[model samples]
Target chain A: MTKQVVILGGGTGGTLGANRLRRELPDDVHLTVVDQDDSHVYQPGLLFVPFGLAHPEDIVRSRRRQLHSGIDYRQESIDHVDLETQTVHLADGSTLAYDLLIVATGAVLTPEETPGLDGPGWMEKVFTFYSPEGAAALEGALASFREGRLVVNVVDMPIKCPVAPLEFCFLADWYFRERKVRADIDLVYVTPLDGAFTKPVASQRLAGLLQEKDIELVTEFNTGEVDGEAGRLVGYDEREVPFDLGVVIPLHSGADYVGRSPGLGDDLNFVPVDEHTLQSKAAPNVFAIGDATNVPASKAGSVTHFEGEVLVENVKRFLAGEDLDASYDGHANCFIETGFHKALLIDFNYETEPLPGHFPASVGMPLLKESRMNHLGKLMFQWFYWHALLPGRDIPGIGADMPSAGKQTETAH
Target chain B: MPTRTIAGATVDVNDEGFFTEPEQWNEDIATELAAESGIDELTPDHWKVLEFMRSEYFEKGTGPTVRVLGKTSGVTVKELYQLFPKGPAKMAAKIAGIPKPRGCI
Candidate 1:
């Protein structure tokens, strides 16, 4: 009897999970991946697209071609999940049953969540790099503008790669400097948080950088609406930020189908998951990963990569009639580019905050630290993403566990 | 705060160390690990490297190259070698707090 596995979303999470399963699972397992379109975008590269550092064509690859030989790729929107019947309904009125299910239908940006956000000035002056179209469009808009106030705002929390907005600001500064119009531009970073970042230590460090770059930092500003016609943003407290150009990371929500499914997800449509096991609270055989789950971790590519490793192991254990391993640490690592050939790296798992030290022990790369080497590593990751990451090959020494070798141990203070 | 036993290490839940919380890490054996070989404490020169490394990571989310570290810290490659006898990988690993470079094995 063949065990059928249906995976929703063919993005990074779904694609990697499927490839790993294909390599590890037996011939008796049937794997099918569902996505809306055939095109798979290298989401991280989207950040660099606006600055002309990366060509849009370089970041896009055919989804089907990336999958394993045996996996089935279906092009259709998921209408909803019938958890009771273990069936998935397609937008075309078709249905498929599976013994096991994986939800990787990453989050979506709702520009409409902010009142007047999608009004007259959207894409013309206000844009978001979260989408491929918005990134490409902003490139042209930014190129022609000689000078004015450029406000980069995060409408709400839990946006993918929280540091990306800051990266945009840094790159924008570098861009204008190169164009010899930097003096005419004013960069302002607006967030709902009290500081520039979530963690206090990181916030203080990042706040200083913002000052060094001459970028204004406005914290705790909860954006209520974007009055595009009026060319301004209105916060909940009625404070207005007038801007010549606004790049907004609007509110984020889980898959559209999640809202339609009853008792499966939260109010935000994110699946209620067992944070440790990556299993869905709705069904024992169902698992969730990436931006689809309500996990208390940054919704970044590294998180998805770490989750895929654990999910594959758990799936194999479940098939063997063994106890499921409840051991998934929310390990997330990211390489942030700070322009001028500098980048920083941080590694933290579920129980570990990002610590300052070298990565891969007292010998490899530095952690929670910056170096031009780190920038090179960031640029090099694109190659690794296409090869090692997507192909499911294990990079030695880089496991699911968070290491403690190089970190400065803090005894009870 | 969540506590779990990983490879005999009684990982503390409230510790602010890297991988210090249950929401961030899991218990998986490392595929390969490099041998440790570097200074444990922060020397004045090491502090120079450490401060620069931490600043860079916070700004960009990656580690620094020895050349950049050298240029920023005003240390020559030969001086860096004397300070970190085992080379950049070992020194970087010691600084990053990771087990070892994944490719080192």
Candidate 2:
């Protein structure tokens, strides 16, 4: 008997999961991947688009082209999933019944959720580099600006690429300096978090870098309204930060379809999964990964890549009626791009915060310290993302668990 | 972890004074924590939000974000700001004997 496996969203997690499952599962199991569109984007390149460092066309490819030969690809909008029925309903009134389901539709930006954010001055003075259109539009907006306070505000947390806004600030500092107008601009990074990042050691280090670059750090500002017409971000507490140009990372939530699905998602529509197993709490046969899950891990591509290894194995185990593997230790690593051709790498998981030292081992990439080598690694990741990561090929030496062998436990002086 | 005496009870607390051991939390301890944050008394409305936070944290292993709390906690966003001044999510979590909601790194 043939078993049906339906995977939602053709983005990073979905594509990787489908490809990996194709390789691991028996040929008797049929796989179908569904998404609204055919274009697969390299999301990391969105950050560089506003700086004119990368073009949109270079970062996008047809979704069908990336999938394996045997997998089925469908371009259709999702309506809802009936958990009890084990079915997915499409917007076109079609339905897919599956023996197993994987929800990978990642987080989406909701600028309209905040009052006045999508209103007047949007794409002119207020811009976001999170999307292809937003990033391309911001390039034009950033080019003409000469002076005044430019504010980069994160409306809230659990956003994809949590460090991108800070990366934008660093890149902007370098961009303006290259244009010799850096001294004329006051850069401010306003966030909902108490500091530059979630982890303590990394936050202190990144905060110091922001200070050295002369960017103002405003903590605990939960933006309630974006009065783009008046050029001010009003927080819920009524605290305000005025801006000449605003780069806002608006609120993020899981796919709207998830919310429409009954008994599947949380308040924000993110699938509640076992933190280690990636098995959906809603049902034993349903699983989730990446930004789609409320896993308390950074919603980054690297996390999705690490999760793919565990998720595929678990899916296989569940089908065999065997005990599922719970070895996923929330391992996530990211290269934080600072300006001036230097970047810092941080590697940590659920239990350990990012510490300073080498990554993978003592001889690997330096961790939590700025270096030109780390910057090069950031640039080279685009290639690895497309050629290696999306295909579910393992990056040798890096695995599902975070390595503690090379990291320094003692605080650095 | 550090120990602090709040409302005559010695409790384990983190650096930010949030209860490290949530089991040590009591209504009296919550009153003292709220008082430190400038809420003179725990009104019925305040307890609604506090109880919601504790239940969500113990069950989910995380405190709810302001957006989540506002949407599902039977508390309106506007009322949440009014009830727990400044940063409602962090402030309410502290008083509710839960660790502050964390941002993903």
lDDT of each: 0.78, 0.92
Per-residue lDDT of A410 in model 1: 59
Residue B75 shift from truth in candidate 2, angstroms: 2.7
Tens digits of per-residue lDDT, candidate 1, A1-413, equal: 98999999998889999999999999999999999998889999999988889888889999988898999999999999999999999999999899999999999998876778998989988999999999999889888989899999988777888789988998898889899999999999998776887755556767887898899999867676797767788865568999999999988889889888777776567797888889998889899989888777888998999888889998898778788888788888888777888877777776676666788798878765668888998898888888988888776777777778987655222
For model 2 the local lDDT of residue B22 reads 89
Q: What is the lDDT of residue A187 in candidate 2?
A: 99
TM-scores of all candidate predictions against the true structure: 0.79, 0.97
Top-scoring candidate (lDDT): 2
Please provide, for model 2 over A310-361, each residue's C-alpha lDDT reduced to its tens digit, 9 standing for 90 to 100. Answer: 9999999999999999988889999988989999999999999999999889
Runs off by more than 4 Å, candidate 1: A409-413, B1-105
Q: Would you list the clashing residue pairs of candidate 2?
A: none
As for model 2, its CA RMSD to the true structure in angstroms is: 1.5
What is residue A411's positional error in candidate 2, in angstroms?
1.9
